[model samples]
Target: MVQHVWSVNELGEWLAAVRIDPAIFDLRPDYCAGLMVVAGISSGPSDTDSDQWLQAADSCDIDLDDVHLEHWRDAYRSFGAKPNRTRPSADALSRRAEKNGLPRINKITDTYNAISVLQRIPIGVENLDAFVGPARLVRADGTEQFDTTNDGLGVAEHPEPGEPVWRDDTGVTCRRWNWRQTPRTAITDTTANALFIVDALGPDAHQRAAVAIDTLRTALATGTPSATRYIDTAD
Candidate 1:
């Protein structure tokens, strides 16, 4: 049994403040692909895991290059940013995994990566304990401090003006909508509580989001047997 459930009122409040209207879909899937989250687990990827990652990457290569992806990319670009320069995290990960192999950041992270590639949608996960307060997704004013790494060195950056971001009281958790995640709330081996946000676009967005979330819930349960999962859609 899972313990500790946070109120989602803050998420609700943030959505109300955003300019872009997204179709939110709450989901609960029966089983997630064998992803697990346990304390002290190694975050390395094995050769076999790498092979599987490559296989999943291969499956999405064509879709990623075709017009299917452009629909959503165009929607994101409509927000005044170049999708290629600031492509959605899921698309970036899929492309990178296919071209250079996936980074094994532990089972939990890898699981989501696989899902993102297969589903072709952006997904964000955070260590709940790192948050200062309730989480919100709002437009960036270019002032929030984003702690991240560049060239193996830790650095601080700011989101572009008018960009959509996920934030808490401390700082921005995700920048450029779902293009990148800040290190401040990144999930790690020691992370116990996690929150996931899945992004979708286009006409069938709600259905796509539902399928992605269900896959996520199942994967999360595989790692944390006591994990409790839930979903909240926008009204």
Candidate 2:
């Protein structure tokens, strides 16, 4: 079950030898092992806060089927999603992404809901200007186009008139996922900095998610500890 699909970029001389906040050089404390996830993926009007992510996915159990409930009802009929399912609680994904305008949570979305409540898997974080470049999570071929929190405008994630996506770019700053962005490309309250990404798939979660993203790119690649080149696409 080496379920494959891979991608990762940055480290362009360590993201141009930034300054700080690569989560303080990957916040290593033995470089984490399992679970510590926190994920918030509200769509316009906060995708009506799907019970604050279904009680953070039942405080950790992430059980959802029917092809992830048909990708949350096809992301609520392709951009207009609110009640983000797996629900009955987070106040039902936050009263359905707050009637379509739930922008307020920060820190790269609370550090991706604290790593999706600590690694239940299926992680997500967005907003590199809501994307158009640096986006290629790969897998989606139904004619991409999404983003129209009712005409505020933006669309594409399944518009296979040409086919191919799973995208999440930043090349030209945001393309479409409908509306899970727009704090001028999100991660606001002055997002000091971020780019922490992880997915860890197949073969025992791809050698422990490639040693947990090379122990977070070698404890943030500037102090010590080395060895990283992800994009292995675990087969």
Candidate 3:
């Protein structure tokens, strides 16, 4: 078993170090991020996990017009990105779940995706082993490196200036806030330590995010889960 070495203090310190640009809150005062850091995850996809994903997909009823989704669209527009051209992560997942159900990526990925669809929130998972440093949410300046894939080939890209992104010391890990994730820190079957981010908006964003995080913790209980701590940027 590949046990993670993140002690309680280290985990809390790492999550505590996650910074969000004050400008982001200025753009959308309702914006809130619910971050959960978990280690000691030791399970692969199973029949139960598949059932949970399927249930969430089957129950998904979100559309672009959803109030929560509209908040994300407005945030994207505030950052000079077209939401229709690049939908929010939750919007894309909801569409997929409605059309053909969500894809089974892996146990960890499936767990977070299920919660995202079921809760109508955007969730991102990161493989901590690939992490370069503490995560930070910032408005990009167009010079950071983002490792992604195009036409099945690995390539590098950069975020547009002033675009919202999640990054570390290396570069951008997720571009446009929650639109796309770089392959550099994407969760895989071998992932044991993971960071789960649940994004919400509107006046009740913090409450909604807390609910989503609770749901995530319950679902992850099927696996050998050990959560380090939970942080809500709204605090």
Candidate 4:
């Protein structure tokens, strides 16, 4: 896999350093487990994998009213943002898959989505070829351009000031701490190099994020040569 420079910026450093709501361990710090891999996309999920996806969706039934999830949601709220407005992608996908069937995107995207639902962690994947790194996690200055779609028409927007986002030299790669990804780095069937970011909360974040990353890495390795690297401020 290709090696890309990744880092947390000054704001990210501050967020990682501060302690918030001592009663809630998830609010203590920001820890992310990131993996960069080079792989070919599969046409689609197999019948067996589709069945596993459904099983994973069923397993998350309890999350519909899970207090732990509420606490996790609250942790994000402490950052001065609304959870519903900036809900982690994993939380949204899990809820949607639990209600409707998971949308089949592609092998790489679907694989990470399945793992996200099963592990209950936010996983963000981006096409490395579309980026001009070094990749960084920082608070947005409200000037970074975000290319997205609205009502099937293309739209370009800017991130809110102080919003947590991942960016490259060009513009915002991901906004709202994984709520939305820009089209510039969206993974498609032709994407050959990609980056997977697993974000976790709570006291067991390190262990949980590690497991999620390893699971995805192992899954991808079965089809192609894959490599992984970890990023954790707590360490």
Best by TM-score: 3
Better model by lDDT: candidate 2 vs candidate 4 = 4
Candidate 3 off by > 4 Å = 1-4, 222-235
RMSD to truth, every model: 7.0, 17.8, 2.4, 6.5
Q: How far is candidate 1 from the true structure (C-alpha RMSD, Å)?
A: 7.0
Using TM-score as the yardstick, the better of models 3 and 4 is 3
The residue-by-residue lDDT of candidate 2 on 1-235, one tens digit each, is 1211122233233322222112211221111112111122122322224335434434554333323323334433443334443231122233333343223364334333433333333333333333333334322344444432445655433332221123443221122122233233344443323344443333354455555444333322322211133343211
Q: Could you tell me the TM-score of candidate 2?
A: 0.24
lDDT of each: 0.61, 0.32, 0.80, 0.66
Candidate 4 per-residue lDDT, tens place, 1-235, comes to: 3533323342233223322122222433645445544445343434466456556665665364554356457666766778876677777887888778677767777778888887777888888657674567676779888888999888889987766777777888888767889887888766665667776766677788788877876776534444555555533
Q: What's each prediction's clash count? A: 4, 68, 0, 0
TM-score of 1: 0.72
After best superposition, candidate 2 residue 125: deviation in angstroms? Answer: 2.2
Collision pairs in model 1: 32-218, 32-219, 36-223, 37-223
Q: In angstroms, how far off is 54's CA in candidate 2?
A: 4.3
- Residue-level lDDT for 46 in candidate 2: 24
**Any idea how many clashes model 2 has?**
68
lDDT for model 4? 0.66
Query: What TM-score would each prediction reach against the true structure?
Result: 0.72, 0.24, 0.91, 0.77
